[model samples]
Target: MKKFWLLIVFVSILFSCSDNNTSNKNPYIPSYSVNLSIDMNLPAYSNLKFVSNGIIIPNYGAKGVIIFNAGSGYTAFDAACPNQALTSCTAMTINGINAVCSCDKTEYSLFTGLGGKEYPLKQYRVEVIGTVIHVYN
Candidate 1:
């Protein structure tokens, strides 16, 4: 009858909407883990830019590029922005002491690794051993 068809249509619409909502949800958490002693040497990092291969290390939290500077005896951060998840632009560009997410122009402080009035970038733990740099979750 007409009522039965209407009920089926309503159910179908409900399920479709639910599916769309679930698909749009951001379920990714960026993290990574790298052995500093073996992967990166601290002395070599000084005053130079060291970039990691696009490796998704789970302990670090999400997919991102790790940039290290040895000149200032400092390391920078670019925790992939969760806001720009679906695109190929997963890496953040470093502008002096800031990490800029190119997708939406979200800027994060490289010194603090905190987002500016936007979404916060997940920071990984950094450990230095002698001349080695280690990045982890």
Candidate 2:
């Protein structure tokens, strides 16, 4: 009876194990301090108040931070292209809800942050509640 209980506990622990997002944690994307919040209802952020749209908020992240309203919620990404060394041209431009890297002409999906590129844009944490959109690294 004791052996049976021990086996059950071991099995439970094994099934409860979880994996981390190591793939998304890229080493190439330089880490910089970031902590910004914007009210989506505000006139300045009105462009981002709608779904399937993105905006670049200056003075944040390595290049800049691009935030998008992807229908579900908001997502933040580093504007620097993850494919190569960071440069001026590597800075991404907002095209609808996609981020285009002029350096290699690669585009990353603003919604999922993964498309038309080997490496996805470095993403940051985003929290939306009420009318506030918080982005942090």
Candidate 3:
């Protein structure tokens, strides 16, 4: 009886576990390998030291990568507009804490990666080591 109960418990616990991995990838943007490190102390990246500020690093991801300082931590997203295909105007330009797409004037928030359209901005992983910010996918 004891052995049967143990087996039942083991089976129940095993069945309870699940893979909860979620991805914020948009279908329009191509997945690119990203492993960039930005030093906040550097003159070029100094603006990132303040909260709610972001910068676009060209020639990195689909169009590029936009790194944002989201107060509590940092976030990085693909510069390509999530709502549309890759075109000359697909690359978004930053407007304060938001990234605006010229194609349809769709606006996306840098802090949350949410946009007005169906697809949200594809997000990358971010890590901060002291003053240096590391972005990867």
**C-alpha local distance difference test of each model:** 0.46, 0.74, 0.78
lDDT per residue as tens, model 3, 17-40: 312113355677778899999999
Per-residue accuracy of model 2 over 33-137 as CA lDDT, tens digit each: 889999978888998877777888877988889988766567788888787777546578988757888787777777667766567778787877789988875
TM-score quality measure for candidate 1: 0.52
Give the higher-lDDT candidate: 2 or 3.
3
- Model 3 clashing-pair count: 0
Error of 3 at 31 (Å): 0.9
Per-candidate TM equals 0.52, 0.78, 0.81
**Model 1 worst lDDT run, 10 consecutive residues:** 51-60
**Decreasing TM-score order of the candidates:** 3, 2, 1
Compared with the true structure, the alpha-carbon lDDT of candidate 3 equals 0.78
Pick out the ten consecutive residues of candidate 3 with the lowest summed lDDT. 12-21
* Reference-based lDDT, residue 99, model 3: 97
Question: Over 4 Å off in model 3, which ranges?
Answer: 1-23
What is candidate 3's CA lDDT for residue 17?
Answer: 35
| Positional deviation of residue 83's Cα in model 3 after best superposition, in angstroms | 0.7
